[model samples]
Target: MRIVADTGRCVGAGQCVLTAPDIFDQDEDEGTVVLRTAQVSGDALERVRQAVHICPSQALSLCED
Candidate 1:
């Protein structure tokens, strides 16, 4: 799976980071979503999906490739 982060739509709620710190982070200045990795697999896939679901701004999505 591939992570799609729309930083422009991010409100920086930090839910993504809180849910999956290994895959997501927040920009210190803008508080936007910063993706640590665009590709996801294994255990991290579920966490990333949870993060996407919890994102207040709907800035995160996963695409199966």
Candidate 2:
């Protein structure tokens, strides 16, 4: 799967970072979602999904590659 983070739609709720720090982060200055990597697999997939679901702004999406 591929992870997509839309900074334009991000509200800096930080739920993504809190749920999956390995795959997501926050920009220090803007407080926007920063994607550590777009690629995801294995055990990390579930975590990434949780992050996507918890995103209040619905800025995160997972696409099948």
TM-scores for all predictions: 0.95, 0.95
Q: Write the per-residue lDDT of candidate 1 for residues 1-65, one digit (tens) a residue.
A: 99999998998899999999988888999989899999999999999999989989999999999
| lDDT scores in order | 0.92, 0.93
| lDDT, candidate 2, 1-35, per-residue tens | 99998999999999998898888999999999998
Error of 1 at 54 (Å): 0.7
Q: Which candidate is the best by lDDT?
A: 2
C-alpha lDDT of residue 8 in model 1 = 88
Candidate 1's clash total is: 0
How big is the positional error of residue 60 in model 1, measured in Å on the Cα after superposition? 0.4
Residues forming the 10-long window of minimal summed lDDT in candidate 1: 22-31
In the predicted model 2, the residue pairs found to clash are: none
